[model samples]
Target: MFTVTPEAQKEVSVFFEGKEVQPIRIFIHGGGCGGPMVAMALDEEKDNDVRFDIGGIPYVVEKDLFEAGKPFEVAFNGMGFAVNSSLQLEAGGGGCSGCSSSGSCGC
Candidate 1:
């Protein structure tokens, strides 16, 4: 399951109000140097996606890529919103050479 902090919910609400339909929050995995990455976006719904609500906002994850054991959190940082995985370092497999432990990769 995933959770959205109160601040994040407010941020998302403000961001999506002008968009068509309800925005769908996408959680993408596996794309960095170490092979897994985290990416977020709002887009139209796609087939085979898992849709859920957090604080009344719509969120989606690719069904095939979804891991039942993963823990996730969404929060707001200033004007931006961020998502985090609560999995251990080992569960992340390994750090990307271009990605700092903080999850910022210049690459």
Candidate 2:
């Protein structure tokens, strides 16, 4: 129940060079300063996941998580990707980590 913007698809294709990308898995993480955020990674299809083909890329989302994150969109933010879940995910500015003046709290 999510859409992947063309730019996002192009980025994903570049990530895998189009021929070797694996099924992508979407997940939630609590590392960013804003709090819990959505992320994606290459993953094998799992029994608990429901497959979705978006922009010709294969994606697998855990059934329960998918239900909770419907009406979402995956977009490319030029430098990277973003997942927008109808405002459930807010923009968490980048460079808010180590090596940057902003430390642990990202402030």
- Highest TM-score scorer: 2
Scanning candidate 1 in windows of ten residues, the lowest lDDT window is 86-95
RMSD of 2: 4.5
lDDT for model 2: 0.76
Candidate 1, residues 30-74: lDDT per residue as tens digits?
Answer: 565556445578676678777777766778777755564256677
User: How do the residues 1-73 of candidate 2 rate in per-residue lDDT, one tens digit apiece?
Assistant: 6789999998887877737768988877654555567778888999999888876689887888888888667
* Runs with alpha carbons beyond 4 Å of true place in candidate 2: 87-107
Question: Where is model 2 poorest over a 10-residue stretch in terms of lDDT?
Answer: 91-100
